[model samples]
Target chain A: MARTEIKIGGFGGQGVILSGYIIGRAAAIYDSKHATMIQAFGPEARGSACSAQIVVSAEPIAYPYITTPQIMIVMSQEAYTKFSPELAEGGILITEEELVKTHNLRKDLKHFSIPATRFAEELGRKMVLNIVMMGFMTSVTGIVGVEAMRQAVKVSVPKGTEHLNLNAFNKGFEYGEKLKSGAA
Target chain B: MKADPKGVVAGAYFIDGDHACAEGAIAAGCRFVAGYPITPSTEIVERIAERFPLIGGMFIQMEDEIASSIAIQGAVWGGKKAMTVTSGPGFSLMMEHIGLAAMTETPCVFVDVQRGGPSTGLPTLPGQGDMMQARWGSHGDYGIIALCPNSPQESFDLTIKAFNLAEQYRVPVLVMLDECVGHMTERVVVPPADEIEITPRRYWDGPKEGFLLFKAGPDRVPPMVKAGDGYNIHVTSLTHDERGYPVMTAAAQEKLVRRLIDKIRLNSDAIVECREEQTAGADVVIVSYGITSRIAIPAIEQARREGVKVGHLRLITAWPFPAKRIRELSHHVSCFVVPEINYGQMVREVERCVAGRTRVERVSHGGGAVHNPKDIYAKIMSCGKEERK
Candidate 1:
């Protein structure tokens, strides 16, 4: 890609920064592309709106901040409300189905939703919801290759929890594949 | 000399500038760090605190920035490569000790991950407002070296350079990082220990008896002796003689202060670093540093697309300002455009260097965010128009 700007937004404790890091690492380290990730640095902690912005490009990324994000993955109502309007024209958006209420979304935009939190709970860890979202994002957007993201997730997650996170990822990936195929 | 293997983490990883800076310090054989945690810069010391113990290094969370700054100097005297990290407010508080470090000729590094400032301005946002402050914040007439990193990779690389320069010159080196670069994450490849060269401290190995503590060698840099190394070394901030006694005389002050300033000023060519792009036969050159350099790239490319013949001079080392290079370029280029995150700091230096040889434009912003590429592109276009006229 020439340059793709991605914004991952959610309340704190949702692995918002970790998800962005994984995506950036996948592209920059594994795929040999250049990626720059910037998090919203503020006093916002758990239960407040938080975000991470990543710019992946074939060339070195300049102007680190995102002017108009091409892709936005939102996991909270507050994040959806705050960031959805800033999505670029015809941009892609992915959100957690159970948490965010999608209303007044742009008609020309491509939208996808995953019950990532529910899938993570089924995998016996609610914290891996972001991993599920990552998998879903991989399936829907294809911004990063599957193997690159898998490797990124393996190295990024805490040791001893990789298997559960990978399982959650596969579940979300499968769901996203089904949705893309019009089988959901 | 090659870096110690214990201190090097050799690999490729996606990391933020703050974490990369800590790794760079470790890879450069920095064994001690002291700092009070502050925003944007807190991660730098946090990484140091976590990784230091593993590599047999030391980290201390001092009560404040003042203590943090002095503690690193103490560590240096105890035969350890040391550094302290902070943001705008903390950097302001540490200015006194920066002067102390300069006067005592202590080899150390002070990392200022700048944020919007003048006293706790925007704690979490980016700002290049501290460029001038890094050069002149401390009182007195002493000179210091300051390096500005535009990206996470440069943050890692230049930090090692900062430590190396500090050791070579026995002066505190400043790694000037804005909050944007500090918080931005990118792929940083740290080479193996054997590949990284470290500048060993200039320690005095001769007889300790009657040793002149403040005597300069042939290179004008005084050799050092650790506090516990059985050397009767007297290190004080006061104007001291060769034996390091507090001498209250005009001759002593002149001799001592002149060397302090001359060590860096005279050897500035060796310490200065910058990158030039397409400057030859160009009408305008954009002088920028830190995050602004990165942000100015698009405008430069756009201006080139519009056939404006624009060049780029990215300042990798912000001080001992690159006056000689700027002066030489001023003869060729019709104008110099400087876009910084501050109202007008480095632009003034560019203007001073140009000295009416050419027109200089200031693209200024009061901190919080970086300049829009469109705005810079507009400036480039206008400069091109002015040149045509």
Candidate 2:
């Protein structure tokens, strides 16, 4: 079976790592796919750009790094610019349009630009933009189920705010689904 | 994946490397963890702090790395498998005491999650800058076992291995982790508790009447009794005779140091581990360790597909450098490529091992980033063409 790698990049506090973790866990727990997620944090975890890579494989994974990505998700302009060069031909590039203005995406590559921040703002929480972006990713790639993603987030997130986060994820999934079917 | 007899199974979970190392220590039956919080190394102590209490173990955050090292030694003397985790800077502070553990033949594990250094260079960046330091950090002529774990899962499994080896040899074992492996989060499978075979440090069940703490015995690991065991335990840092007493005599010091050194030196065959990947009929061999080795694997496969006979030798146990294996492989491979995060630390060992037989070239980088596989593969492909000429 072929292996799929997804790269998520954004400035710290964007929940970039949290989104990667959810995707990895959803693939493992729900889809029964072997998954690995790794993050690289700078000393300035609060201000500097943070990046995470999640590899989902139907077969057991040996090495857990993604040098080249088949799917790229960027939450900020800086993240998009940094990761765009690594996207392979025929790859999927799903990014937030509200934060990043423009990207020099290859013509053949599939690109989905969602206003993740705006969607989260409508939900009354800008911090949940990562979940919105993740929902969009799952809709386009079908890499994992939205319910599986919710369960993964519930298990990993700190207790007491599970309901709010679940609502945010569902809203995000709906936002992505509308865009995918050209119904939005 | 085959089931490890040590009750752990493969399951994907999000865990930082430091927490994984702590879990590895616990699974290895390390009941005592004594350490002072040092940056990059702090999370290891934190994970142990949170997990040890839950697992019915002890976690003591000492005032400094020195005290932590001392406490770990004390715990081992008290007949408990103990460990202390630290980084490059803290490792430098614990060197003197590490010598004490060596001379006293204390079987405890000390993990050095290496960062950029030579005195607090980069507190959070990853660097394999401690390879030579691990070998010669502790003073004097002594042999020690140092294992390097490349990923979170290995960090967990190898910590157990470190404890087992230390217990078997009656010496301090070093687990060398870099900042990358110490902090990176990955999916790890934690086996069931009953699956692991844990070997505690060998203790004497002989007569309690006249138990000598440092008596030279058949296993070289003499039976040790604690202070309240009704036996006078004289564990000292000074060069002493086998009775665990200080002896200033030159002949006596020679015998003592010789035995301390000989215990590990004589058993070199049992302590060395080097992992081979597609080395049977290869022209270019990539030699790496820790996290870099994980990258080198895919790079080797890529090179093989491109029609280059490139193989890999990853070091799980860095020190007690795999001299014999490298020397053997040198005769067949055209070149040995040693890639590390440091400028050039481990390459020196690879160069020394293959001396005069094969070319030892290094693709070294030290700015807190890992060597990209493309660079390593290009170097190997270039070396392959040069060999044909």
Candidate 3:
């Protein structure tokens, strides 16, 4: 199956929801891939951990929710603790180094420690942590192109918020570039 | 034996019950579907969305069940057959709009693919906990048409019938399939569109002069023209007369309310449906519907092969209670076995219909597990065997 499972987890209202939806839409609309976005949230929209799974495939998708995830995106320390065990062995784990202090990280899994929250704050948008991570995901995994991600955000974000979300997205893309230069 | 054309298309193909319901809605000529995703019913929304776009129909995922219900009412007012599907929790959320649909006499179909409940008890599991709720969920004395399908094919067939009845009576109808029937994968035969009989909303072609929205001319159902159509079709939740204008007077409420309930009550004989096996001279009669009926049929057949005079009553239409058939079956049978997925919900109705004339017993299971036919057979043989006395 060409379908790939990507999971995003964080406390509710952290924009993990927007990130997952954008990813799913990007795959479906821009890349001609079938996509399914499944979300689980606690009763409280804020302060409670939330998780969303996005499956993008070239084939017609069956079973919208993914049973196993190939990539894990954790935005908070609690999110990392909650979803760390469920990540597929040898899968990639990307998280903000500022918020998630201690992680029960495994040896085989590759972890990317990016200052997504700091980047969002630097860009004057505290809620763009998910957007930054979305950028890092597309850059690192090449699962979705940055242009497709930007187009996805443009189409999905509500009427007035498009320009600000796109700016946050570009800031995230720049952050990924910095990480790539440091590695080089 | 030469096969009839209608029966020729009733063969089986592999499909899930939820998928069959979506297909059934389309076959019923449903042009609009509005729903929010809830387990056991999410497949219905997904399937509808996938197909509706291609068929030039509208499929919307509203903010909540309440909004979904309202959106469907709007679409139906736009002159399209509309439907919504949800599970127990979502169905609970939809009761308010259901009451609205009743008061306004809006024609639509609501499918409640039941699951374990009381509050998100189990998302992926099966349950028949919503039987009572389906009948009396909305707050008020009102009537509704509900059908319970035992298999995937019935899910499709009954969904079509639900829309037909809704349009025919200008009332809301429900397809109450439980999680077992909703989620179970089985073979289903999908007939071409031309093979199925579809009923659209009856619209009055007469001029706008002297148009009373609530008034029934020759037939009890008033012709409903679409919103943008020149006719002034005013419908509301308030008490209204044939003119469709709200009136505080008790006289107007009396006439309108009576017609709302009487429409179904008067025509229940034609609406009631059931399947029977060896009902004549049988000592034991097992009564069931939906997934429970699925098990009861085999158990009754097994008992018959074993030389026991056990008969089956599989109820396809649960609402209106199929009271006449149950009463007739009760007269001939000594014992009644009610196998249900709920804890004695439908059994109560069976008891009431049977009264003290027949000994009515319940074979019940809930919280997502189905009752085994062996258990029902054992219960029947123990209580219903003629030689036991």
Candidate 4:
């Protein structure tokens, strides 16, 4: 892509920033592209609608803020309601199935939903939900390669839990592949 | 000297400017850091707190910005490279100590990840409003070095340069990072230990029996001796002589203060740095620093595409104001456009240097966000048209 703008939004504890970081790192470090990630800062980010914006480009990203995000991964109802309307025409919308309600979405957008938290719970750690979502994002959008995201996730997660996170990512990736093949 | 291997994290990784700055401090051999965490700048201290222990360094979370500012000075006197990080409000709280550091001629770094503010404004947004305050906030005729990095990679590289400048000049150096540059994340490649060069403190190896503590040699910088190093030293904020005693006379003030100002003023040729592009034959130039410089690139390109003959001058070191270069360009260029997040801080400097030789246009923003490139391009186009007329 010439330039791809991605916005990830959720509450504070959902690792919204980390998911953006993983995606940005995958593109910038592993895939040899330029990526700039900026997170929502200050007091309001604690328990409210926090977000992270990532810009992936073939060249250096001069403008940091996203005007019209080409992709939005919302993990909360508030985030969905607030940010979904701002998605560009013919953009991609990825959301957590159990958390966000799809309503009044743009018809031109390519929408994908996954129960990332439930998948993480099935993998025995609810904290890895962001990683699962990241895996799904990688597979669904193909913004970054699968192996590159896996490498980024390995180095990014907390020590001693890389195995669990990788498993969660694999589960989400498998689900995304199944959905893409129209078997879900 | 090459960086110490223990402090160097040699690899390619994606990290924010704040974390990259923390790594630069470690790589620059910063052994002690004292800070009170604040928004937009907390990540710097947090990263330092996490990595300092492993590098055999110390990180102290002080009660507040006041204590945090002075605590780093004490660490410097105790024979350690020290620093403190903060945002606008904390930076305001630190002005007094900054004066003290200037007076005492301490070698330390102060990382001000600036946010929008006169008083506690916009903690989450970016601002370049502190440019003037960094130079004159401390109410004195003393000199300090301040650098503004435009990207995360420069944030890592210039941070080390900040420490080196502090050591070389024996004065506190400021790393003036706005919120945008501080929080913006990107790929940073930290070189191996052998690739980095460090400037060690110029310690006095002469006899302590007849030492003049505040005396300067040919370099206009006094050699330092650590406390508890068996040397009698007196460090105070008052005007003193070479012996470090309060002279309290006009002569004493001139002798002490003149050297303090001259140290950086005379050596500004070595201290000041900037990046210039297409200035060899251009009609208009855009002068900018910090995040504004990055945003100005596309505007410059756009103006060039419209055949405006535009050049770019990016300020890597904002202090000692690259006046000589600007003055030289003033003679040839028809106009100089300055775009900053502030309403007009550095624009005044450009006007002063131009001295009515050329039109100086200010593309000012009031700090919440960066400038729209189209706005800057419009200014450039107008300037170019004016020049053509």
Which candidate has the top score in DockQ? 1
Against the native complex, each candidate's DockQ, computed on alpha carbons, is: 0.90, 0.46, 0.02, 0.78
TM-score, cand. 1: 0.98
User: How well does candidate 1 reproduce the true complex, by DockQ?
Assistant: 0.90
Instruction: List runs of model 4 lying over 4 Å from the truth.
Output: none
Error of 1 at B90 (Å): 1.1
lDDT (0 to 1) per candidate = 0.92, 0.81, 0.79, 0.92
Clashing residue pairs, backbone N/CA/C < 3 A, model 4: none
Q: Write the per-residue lDDT of candidate 3 for residues B1-389, one digit (tens) a residue.
A: 12123322343344568988988887777879999999888888888898787777889888999899899998888888899999988999999888888888899999999888778877777788888888889987788889999777789889989998998888899899977677654446677555777776788888898887787854567778888988876888888878778899878877887787788888889888988877788888888888787667556767778878887888888887888788888887889888887788988889888888879988888666667678887888876555467
Q: Score candidate 2 by lDDT.
A: 0.81
Model 3 has a DockQ score of 0.02
Docking class of 3: incorrect
Report the CA-based lDDT of candidate 3 relative to the real structure. Answer: 0.79
State TM-scores per candidate. Answer: 0.98, 0.90, 0.66, 0.96
- Candidate 4 lDDT tens digits, B1-389: 88999999899979889999999999999999999999889999999999988989999999999999999999999999999999999999999999999999999999999888878999889999999999999987999899999889999999999999999999999999999999999999999999999999989998989988899988799999999999988888999999889889999999999999999989989889999999878899999999999899888998888888998998888988899999999999998999999899999999999999989999999887889999999999999877777
Question: How accurately is candidate 4 docked according to DockQ?
Answer: 0.78
Ten-residue region with minimum lDDT total, candidate 4 chain B: B380-389
Best by TM-score: 1
